[model samples]
Target chain A: MTGYIEKKHTFRSWVIEKLFMGKTIKEYLKGLITPFNFVAALILLVGVPVSVYRFTQGIGPSTNLSDNNPWGLWIGFDVLAGVALAAGGFVMGTAVYLFGLKEYHPTVRPAVLTGFLGYFFVVVGLCFDLGRPWRLPYPMFVSVGVTSVLLLVGWHVALYLATQFVEFCPALFEWLGLKNFRKWVIKLTVGATIFGAILSTLHQSALGALFLLTPGKLHPLWYSSFLPVFFLISAIVAGISMVIFESMLSHRVFGNRINHQGVDFDKLTLGLGKAAAIGLFAYFALKWVGVAHDNRWDLLNTPLGHWFLVEVFIFVFFPCLLFTWAVRKSNAALVRFASIITVIGIIINRINVAIVGLNWNLEDRYFPHWMEFAVTITIITVGVLTFRWIVNRMPVLYEHPEYKEIDQ
Target chain B: MEISRRKFLKSISAASGASLVSKSQFAHGAERFTGWPERFGILTDITRCVGCRSCEAACNEINKLPAPKIPFEDQSVFEKIRRTDAQIYTVVNRYPNPKPGGPAVYVKKQCMHCDEPACASACLVKAFKKTQEGPVIYNKDVCIGCRYCMTACPFYVPAYEYDEPFKPEVKKCTMCFERISKDGIPACVEACPMEAMTFGKRSDLIRVARKRVIEQPDIYIDHIYGEHEIGGTSWLYISGVPFEKIGFRMDLGTTPYAELTKGFLGAVPLVLILWPAFLIGVYMFTRRRQEMVETEAENFEIEEDQQ
Candidate 1:
């Protein structure tokens, strides 16, 4: 009875705060008119219409996708690259929850939030790319293709999105000022974390397995039997690097919102950088192992071979070395710079596997049409804006003071 | 509980630096279906092909496809290489015969319809199917139009209706599924004036191809294309010149693409089984520590109250 009354009172109070939060609401609205929002608005302006054009006119007009090249930047960048970029959730969840690293708690909620939003948009982009997006459920509820790697990808991503939502519910409950609901949600933390970790491991690798059927089509340098393993390894670094990278940006952009005294973000960056250094080092070693196992030494002599070297040495290896140097010296700025390169390396690797490295010998290379670029940029812009909105509204970046004991 | 950088590095490497898995030991799970033993198939002898477009015209008429801009009787259509599209399910392309004086060789290309079709394996909705009669058929009602089958097809046979805004589908050769299953031959086979194409049981066709190769070693290539490529296809080819010279990919291995992904899929069950137990154990350990901390905090508060 007391719990019911308390919930009702808090619900009423929450409504009052939203309707008339005094200058707080006005200040947030005023803050939205920055130069950054202008660029985002401009992208949506063009991109929204282009997406509408794609739907009405068909994928032919909006994309450079051909019978020769069925998949383009939308699948390559928006879905594949976006899913990888969102790896921070499982990586941090595993580090803090499973490994018992209490020091990493402050970073956990943001990582989970990033992951949920990232996957949510991957589905959005996937729906756009599909010819009949409405029938997507046929693979799930209607008729399951047991042998399909893509089927595994679809089911696992859907489940993982839900799991991440549940994993982040404590923050949501607190935002709603539902004390009893928040306490109920906190009890589900351990199960949800484990479930998220399992799904993360599967779907992350399943995305790579989606290309396994196209072994002859994907370039020899990229195609390997160990693609799933490689994807999982690189995703770990992608996750760690993304957290280090995102938190650095979050600290700069949302400086006032952060509890700077409580959480020393500089130290956090260096710590995350240390973990990423190890992952990147392993990822580099494994990539060569894939090449050697495939006996692609002859490919190293070709022009694409040189390009592969650039991807490895410059983007992957150099950032790894920089991470080590930064961690050893506790150079937060250099670590931040290395994280940016690591993010770039992840993007290049995904694009290389999906686009450039695929059909490398074909005469006609597929370059995304201008509209394709607009759609991809728009999807990314929407993800960023949504992330900013949640961070501003919810208890994502900082721990809610009311529930400090539980979350902290 | 300060974590030493060296210990953390050791753990990180131990986790992500596990031994690399090689393809040599990997088994593609194609053993589940050895394929219908008595399945019917087509064998094409390129040496006998006359570069006539009668088969193409017959296919267009029988499938009720849109009429071609260049009528089938026009010999000028063979001036350039052509690919099959939504309007046509098959096309014959002329290539210069290896010998200088002989007539130009013509090759008819369509869906290979593998014994274990990759399209069937890749479709998440089970839209593409390999039938008992050997034709790779499709169920349009179940298809989500993801175009993954196009990516999976090594032959690049499947085409899409990019012009259709609302209800597009994957268009490909059905190997005359409607006609062949009903005691009738494919329209293309019946329309072949030179009698270059032969259709029969896959095993019988292989033996027939071997006999032809042995009888005319000088005139035909000893090896039959698609006999073992991608774990054998229903469509077989024999040509006097090298298969590669006429745009055939010699690189597609005998190991079926389905088998290639089985190793990854095989590991999936193990992960799903092991992850929960391991994670829950970790969760228990972490929860125990939290309980201890809570109890210690409670004791400290009681001590303060006594003071």
Candidate 2:
């Protein structure tokens, strides 16, 4: 009876003939670069030149960065904001692999792949913003300033990228039918997950630690010695929120495959929503402690201070409450909406620290130039292309063919 | 299970030693020295400054820096106080109304070499160093140009040579280490015709500043500006007017800037050691559930086969 049911499901899926199943490698490659590839190619064609121009011309000419503000939209939005959004990968990886939650195994590959691509783009964005791109390795090998938060962040990002790459390799191996190689890759899963978590914790917090030294320069409301702790906790919330958001997006975009594969959205969203709720609660408490510890009650009335309050209340506080409500009610749609808001709040908080909060006393604020925008968009576009390319080729978005009949 | 037991034992050992590690982590046994001893330092006396651009002129000459748009003889430079930039390492700004009815106070703006300098602490490559004589200097040869020092500086003194296409370095007042090491005063200090600048031991300069303030309390502000600011700077300022009027950031707290990252820094090793075990434990606990599910599936398959 079980064999009969499996055969029936296979026949249903087999209705769409596998045209590429027996095709030559060359033919497959030729057929693979479709209109989507053309769009991606067009973006790269325009983006590469702009990126080259930025590289040749100094950051001063390429961006609207001023002496008053060292970091601008590129650093704030692209690197900082992008990294926080990518936190979903590590959070989900930990949930399924580290916590042995086999039920979440389906989401793990997609989450890890997203993280890997997100960090890759962050590095690309950093290269564009870096004044001396050639001297980038000096911080890693030559100088190794152990004391600087950037040094810690740089090392962690570098290491974590490698760890994420390793964690995602099994999917590639499985897709290629390299069963022996997949076993070796699977052996690395536990170690890589742990290492990735540690690196993520440090680097996520280190982003906030970068602002700790700028106590007087940064607005009092945002600057705290415990910024690293705050950032780490917020990253937990942000990561869970990102996973929830991405899962919904993926569900919509690949509904045919997901539904055919029997992807469990309800259970996944509930688990992610629970994680987000806890993270948000911790994050809210830490933010309050940051304000109270610093005795910054008077700052709340000022305009910049009011903006900070809004960031905390409207974005952070509201989404947190919404996330909790969604989790209790098992409202996947509400959880999805709250996750998007939570992600936005994380971006706002990062920008506030890296740019908005910086030079708060200055009347003239720094803004990004068109060239800077072009370069940042180019990097993000590249990331999206890479993500699409991987998802198309790897088993990240679907269950393994061998495991399709296995009941959970 | 074997791995878990070993990890549990390792964590127990680590937990037991946590107190010891915490103590050794921050409790730097008291040495009177805040940083490198015998460090080269600069001493600036605000009372002696006469708003002359001689030090500015001398610095340009000695460093072989670019000639200013306005020549040294231009007293009009006093109308606007200037900051150090890519081209200039030191600038003397004129502060009016520091004392009502008194002569306008001339304040030399430069890097205040602190006892525990934040810039040095912040530099990743050890490119910026606090020489034993009290001067915080940068080595361009080893510099990666990360500019962590620029952000860490409380005084906002470190300026990057952003315009330089090839190799840009952090430009700052080095307290004239090259000349001072040879027992010569800084070019700026030596060129002060009004004897506004004094070059001496940081310890001696503080005493000299206090004595001058005591002798003529009516002529100067009672407080010595850098004496205790951010762990006491090498340059001591005795101003006739308030320090804030002259672009001094008085809000910088006394704690050394590196103290801020100490919490996270101390936790790095702890996290490095513990996170792997913690995560693996979670993996094991989860794996057990997966195994149970697999077993249940196997039993269901067997029952279906029997039927």
Candidate 3:
């Protein structure tokens, strides 16, 4: 009887150890680093010095800012473009978890995690460009301008960050093998997911509304009263495209996880392709309407007008048509290419709005300094590192069928 | 369960249709209204300006702004057109020829003090305010040094104190709100040797501007520069030449600058209030159908096992 009791105790301990800690720290680190770390590290080495120079010497010293133009690549590419691209994770999270599309469950964890990290980096990028980042919270607590679009953006970004964190908590719970807590989190997922979706819609549009306040400063071709709506819709397209791009990237970089989970990349890609097509179609129609509403057809004859047409036709129109064709054909490769083009289109649109379109008549335009580029790169490196850290420990890309079976 | 699936599909279709309808309605609604009224403003008359630089001198003295590269008395300063900087709050620029053979034209460079002043609207913190007395003022104490207001300003009036290490703020024309409140003229207006920079109620300024344009049509542009530009600025201008030729933006249109974002801003509350309920309803509708189907499947399995 004594021997049997000892044996039973040892077996129980073994089960606990296996379930609670799937892999040792060393093993987890090895899995996390994957070849991607080297590329991220190389990018960081160049990015760190640039960021330091920006803080010490000021933005004017490092960037091409002038009295005629103030905003540059930092605001245009890193903050605006980066934020739009990250919209994918939230859009996917809403479709799968909130809408109870069980087929999309496998994509939810990674998508939300990506969304969370993407936004986190966007805030970091913004802080770097802000002349006084130390006083950032003044907008949140000390003085609130409820009427301003930026105030809405500031609040929404904060709230959405918290929402994304909650949305991603279940993955962490699963990684820890905390079945009871994980179950509780799963129950709240629907609420958190929906809340995130709502916040994403508001803030993404608010980013565009921030530009609307400068109607005279921005070029007539880009300026529109419907700027917020345009931004919100474009973000939807950007988000879907970003997910497709990231998924393809993950498939290449972390094939082990994809293989382990037996993820149906073909089906996932198809679904995303469909979403991209719909979003692009709507966005294209709106672009035309925006031009029409402003009656800016006369501008098309000028050089600046021609540039606007190029941005719309080559970047927006082409990619949108490509997305539709790729989705209908169920061609994953074609869809992936279209997704990349769509992301490029978003970048072009944002850059045009923030930089190219601003002070169009001025002979001098603001160009970003090397230091600004460095800081942008550094922030991106940090985002990549954070993503690696989360994916390493969390069950973000894997299924824990054992946990589900045990609960049953 | 089958019927519930159909109902869920129907609801989704209806909801999507509603979203489309609302989107079109939003587009129409935005185009209908011009912009908000009761906006702060300023007016400058180019024809009345005499290149005395008294407004520039007074602005520097009152704001405690730093001295300029060129002394106020140096008549040669008129040879080169200058812009406002962190140190200078205002400048008077001279156009060498007003009407090809006429005397030199002088236009003051300061904040336009737009009707829906974009700087005030853009500031995240309530640092910038559109005072009822037709001045857009900045509160440095509340500023976080974001410089978004600088970016948003159509006229690029606000300049950042980038050289300051610990504390920095946006510097711009405040329309002398403190003096105006005390029933005094703005320092610039008071110091103007030619009465070029007029100080009066916005309503009176418009009337004065119209009289000047109507009295001497050849000496002034028929259009008042700020009366309708960007929803009417506090400082109005009447130029002998086209305003565009004399460095004014002609494309600003009559709508208040801030009105551009009104449709989106107004929609924010509506979205905030409605989106959650709309999404939750969809969630519950989907979840309930899933549960009913699961329960039916479970009941069938149990009956089979019992048999």
Candidate 4:
């Protein structure tokens, strides 16, 4: 009886230690009252009800979507921009596991966690946009539209989310102190990485292919047969820049948890900047190639044409030059700054394609309703909170001492 | 000279049975589908229309839609050109006639129902289908209400019940599928006192449109509107004025919209096949290179220790 009691006591202590950061309930509650948490709570308080109201009220009342514009902010920012930013997982996974660049292995766990959460929230955002959210799995199980580009996107996103979870399983297991499970998951890493790459390549491009059927609806300057290629190459840029951008933020926010371990983080940032420069240049060339292929030179002087030029020149070309200069000068701060701009540029590009350039000739244009913004902000807040919670507890920023050698 | 009818029939059946058995699967590996051979179509003669809203009323009644705010006979509704909406599946818009001081041209607008439907290609859940009959029908039971069909449609035909929170559906012209399937003409066609619309097999409709255009060159344009637009639609049109002037887009090419995504979708399986093999190859190569470097470093360290 005494032995069983002692075991129960130890288990309780373990839970308090692991879950509460070795603090008493009162102490943990006090620690949670930080400025960040207060703001997050306030946002959620208002945002959560707005999302509920959306389910009760219907999309028309909550959003500016009309017959002319079916897709809006949820698809533009939440799904497209979210998916692009989350490309860091496949990028880092391929670098560490497939190409055997072990130095980048540290960023893999956080990247995968961010990616997994990002995709999870994308589905959540899609639920808000879909009229029947419960039937999301119908495409996979009930009726499959094999010829559709969206079916490819649906299947790939679902499969890739699972793959990312598997890839990040080691960190999760290590956090839980499950020795045997962590060992088994580590063995599956390379296989999962390869599968992630395959899935990522198809879905990222398939998102672009969704617009191919709207050649007449989308503006001539933005529409092209090479949309899929442009999307894929730019996604690669988004991935690399996102890794740099995320690491910069993570090192600042979670600085105490990360052990430097003599790793040259600045060197890694510059290396990523170099790859991003290459991707941006290729994307820039392809943008003009698309223009020339369509022979839409006359359109370059119109107002919408001017906007397209701004997107191509300021966003794509300028970022290419900035990344190149930053890499050549070995300026890590500049690289980080360039990454911030690149991330914003990717968001702009997605929004332009999904909203601005679509139905350009229409008289009634669509702008997101405030309720739509609230729902979007709510989703992002929840995602960030989830990311923070996992990062704080899991073996993401630092290696667990018990299995340090076994992790690799 | 003494051949019996039964002997001849037996030989003919033996020779043709193999081909007849495979006719249902005739679409397999065909270079292009020319739609269902005997599919029906509607050919509208624009000159014959007199801006009558009877067809609209008939469509509404047959579809069991909510009553319009303005009565069907109210001619004031033509002041503003309108589109199909959640409650309204078809609309009639009045455009300025090409000839100055002439009467306005009233065009009936609804779903074009392309031979290779863009909605069918865009739907992730296969909610929409091109039926063997003329109508491109929708199955609401399987619909997830993504509204991608609204975006994919060239004519901007499909509308969503945005007001219905729980049971939203994509609303569009069914071409009176229930009536057509039961061997009855559409309510709109039956309601038209002007006989402006003709319903028949798609091929016969094309022939009728061609004969009208050739017979009345001065009165009709030298084109059949939907005959070759986006790989031919079930709804054909013959107009006296230029199609562009009456709100029809002439820029839509003859290629089926489904062909646009074919290359990308085709590459999906190719990636699934090739990407893993390539990644594995690279993984093996990198692992071998790393192993070689470690061994070389170990050999050097051993020699130094001996020294």
- Give per-residue lDDT, candidate 3, residue B174: 82
TM-score of chain A for the candidates in order shown: 0.94, 0.88, 0.88, 0.98
* Interface RMSD, every prediction, one decimal place: 1.1, 1.8, 1.7, 0.7
Chain B TM-score by candidate, in order shown: 0.85, 0.84, 0.79, 0.92
Q: What DockQ do you compute for every candidate structure?
A: 0.53, 0.38, 0.40, 0.81
Better of 1 and 2 by TM-score: 1
Ranking according to lDDT, highest score first: 4, 1, 2, 3
Q: Write the per-residue lDDT of candidate 4 for residues B127-184, one digit (tens) a residue.
A: 8999999799999998998888888998899999887899999999998889889999
Candidate 1 lands at a TM-score of 0.91
**Where does model 1 exceed 4 Å of error?**
A1-16, A19-31, B1-32, B285-307
lDDT of 1 by residue, B179-198 (tens): 88998888899999998889
Candidate 1 local Cα displacement, residue A238, angstroms:
0.6
The DockQ score of candidate 3 comes to 0.40
Lowest lDDT 10-mer window, candidate 3 chain B? B32-41
lDDT of 3 at B123: 80
The model with the greatest lDDT is: 4
**Greater-lDDT candidate between 3 and 4:** 4
Off by over 4 Å in 2: A1-46, A256-260, A403-408, B1-33, B287-307
Highest-DockQ candidate: 4
Model 1 chain A poorest 10 in a row by lDDT: A15-24
CA lDDT of each prediction against the hidden true structure: 0.88, 0.79, 0.79, 0.90
Residue A31 shift from truth in candidate 4, angstroms: 1.3
